[model samples]
Target: MIKNIIFDFGDVFINLDKQATYKELAKLGVTEVSEEMMQVYYRYEMGLITTKEFIDFYHKKFNIAKKDLINAWNAILLNFPLHRLEFLKELEKSSKYRLFLLSNTNELHISWIQNDWGNNLYQEFKNCFEQFYLSHEINLRKPNENIYEFVLGENNLLASETIFIDDTKENTDIAKNMGIHVWNINPETEDVVNLLNRKEFL
Candidate 1:
């Protein structure tokens, strides 16, 4: 019996073009995602560095405009469907299980969401979750055992009685290995609104 649910924000609620940022960067002369660049990105996601420092590294390295870099970085974000908000609101109102959000997101992505979704709607979505953990805010990211352990320990949640839903296999695999139920959803074919009807719950 699942007593708690942890959901990923991107693709689960708000739609995302996962490759859009990379594609945008390519157009800006960042033709390759080097290992160093990836490491810097991970560090930025963990909030280990300031946003300016992150942007500046690329600015000084690539000589790209700061505004262009920010735009490309935020290209992954997309619209959040109103129906999903309604679904989440219903889920929250039901009070059937403790709900949480754990997302691997940075400041730029969040700013884009706030601007695109508006403050009111974003607040409503956030209020639905008992604990909303963003990677940049928490300095802990998914697919990391300690991060999952942190959530479980902090909330006193039983791993066996929790379900973790994410769009990425890497994240879900770690959760599943630790006794938590997982749904590695395919956003292209699946929707979060059908959570109740998913065979995992049934």
Candidate 2:
């Protein structure tokens, strides 16, 4: 029986245009993704660099304005459907399983979400989870075994009793390898509000 539920934030709860950031950056002359750029991004995601440093790297490398760069960086984020929150709240109220949120998110994206959703709505969503782990905040990221281990160990959760839901196969694959049940949901066709009704849980 699955007694713990772990969810990915993007696409699972909040809609995202994953290509929007790259598209917006291309407009600012960031036409190519260099290895260094990816390294910097990985570091930023792990909280190894400050937001200022992240912005500054692009500002200097692409000669893009701070405001424009910030806008491009945040373009990947879209809307958070309220229905998902309602479903999550219902799950939380049931108290049948411990809930968690684990996402590979950076500070700027999180700050933008807080600002866009307003404090009340953001807090309401957050309150549904027993532990909310953001990559930057925790210095760990998905598709990494240690992160999965950390979540399980810290919470004293059994992998066999946990179900991890994510929109990315790369992430879910790692968790699945560790013996956790997974739902590699396709956001284009599936909605998290229908979670329990899915075949895995049914």
Candidate 3:
């Protein structure tokens, strides 16, 4: 039986445009995504670099201002539907499973979320989870074998009894390979509110 549920924050709970950042960056003359930029991005996501260092790299390389860079960086985040929170709350209240949130997220995006949702609302969402793991804070990221191992080892969770839900197939695939169950949700048509109804959970 599945006794643990690990959820991805983006798309699984909060809505995301995914490409909005690219489009926004294009408007600021960032037409091409360079390898160095990608490396910097990955490093930023892993918390290997400071936020100021991240913004400064872009500001220095692309000649983009800090504020504009921040704006473009945060453009991907969208609204959180109330219904998803309700579903999560109901699931948490059941006490049937230990809940967790694992996301490959950076500081700017989280700051934007906190500002947009307000601390109280953000806490309301966070409080539903037994553990909240942010990639930057944790210095680990998804699709990485070590990350999966960390989550499993840290909580003493049995991979066989854990279910990880994510919108990205790559992320889910890694967990699935580790003997955990997964739902690579299609946000375009699938809603997390129908989780228990999914065949994996059933």
Clashing pairs in 2: none
State the weakest 10-residue window (summed lDDT) of model 3: 193-202
Give the C-alpha miss distance for residue 94 in model 2, angstroms. Answer: 0.6
Each prediction's TM-score versus the true structure: 0.98, 0.99, 0.98
What C-alpha lDDT, on a 0 to 100 scale, does residue 154 get in candidate 2? Answer: 99
Candidates 1 and 3 compared: the better one by lDDT is 3
lDDT of 1: 0.94
For residues 1-202, write the lDDT of model 3, one tens digit per residue: 8999999999999999999999999999999999999999999999999999999999998888899999999999999999999999999999999999999999999999999999999999999999999999999998899998998899999999999999999999988999999999999999999989977677
Q: Which candidate is the best by lDDT?
A: 2
Give candidates' CA RMSD values in order: 0.7, 0.7, 0.7
The runs of at least 3 residues in candidate 1 whose Cα sits more than 4 Å from the true structure, single-residue gaps closed, are: none
Q: Assess each prediction's global lDDT (C-alpha) against the native.
A: 0.94, 0.95, 0.94
Which window of ten consecutive residues has the lowest lDDT sum in model 1?
A: 193-202
Clashes of 1: 0
lDDT of 2 at 148: 97
